[model samples]
Target: MLSIKVLGSGCANCKRLETRVRKVCADNDLDATIEKVTDYQDIMRWPILSTPGLVINETLVSQGRIPAEAEIARLLKS
Candidate 1:
């Protein structure tokens, strides 16, 4: 299973990102563990300068903005 993390402080964008990740996983039938990292310290460990970060398999894939659903699907496949 893929390990996915959405790093943020529970903001709108953060929630949206998490939702998108979940949708992608569901649509593709991908097995993934989606986690939310809200603690500042925990989020910083991923080298993100802003909230709404997306991490896949412990790798930082996005930050600072909400990505499109198509882009998210692509990321998951990678």
Candidate 2:
């Protein structure tokens, strides 16, 4: 199963990102655990300074803004 973490400070973009992550996992038929990191200190633990960071299985895959669906799918496949 894939482990996904959406790191942000509970902004509108953060919520949207989380939603997209869930949809992607479902649409792709992937077994994933998606979690939202809303705490500032928790978000800071990663090497991302931007909101809406994407961490897949503890690896920082993307950050700053929302990513393309194809990009996400490709990431999951790898």
Candidate 3:
């Protein structure tokens, strides 16, 4: 299974990103576990310097902004 991590501090953007990620996973029938990382230290562990980051199986994929659904689906598929 894929491991997906969303790093944020429980902000609105973070919540929105999580919602989008969940929808993308469901719509694409992706078999992945989604985890929310709110701790600053954990977020910093990744190569992300911004909130609302997306990490897939330990690979940092996106940060700072929400990605398009298509892009997210592609990431999840990979």
Model 1: lDDT to the true structure: 0.93
Candidate 3, position 24, lDDT: 94
Worst 10 residues of 1 by lDDT: 42-51
TM-score per candidate, in order?
Answer: 0.97, 0.95, 0.96
Clashing pairs for model 2 are none
Question: Candidate 3's residue-wise lDDT over 1-78, tens digit each?
Answer: 889999999999999999999999998788889999999988899988888999999999999999999999988887
* RMSD in angstroms between candidate 2 and the native structure over all alpha carbons: 0.7
Evaluation by lDDT, superior candidate among 1 and 2: 1
| Lowest summed lDDT window (length 10), candidate 3 | 42-51
Write the candidate numbers in order of decreasing TM-score: 1, 3, 2
Q: Rate the local accuracy (lDDT) of all candidates.
A: 0.93, 0.90, 0.93
Q: Please, what are the lDDT tens digits per residue for candidate 1 over residues 19-55?
A: 9889989999999999999999998898889889999
Task: Summarize candidate 2's per-residue lDDT along 1-78 as a digit string, tens digits.
Answer: 889999998889989889888888889999999999998988999999888999999999999989988888889879
Deviating ranges (above 4 Å) for candidate 3: none
Candidate 1 TM-score over all chains jointly: 0.97
Error of 2 at 44 (Å): 0.7
lDDT for model 3, on a 0 to 1 scale?
0.93
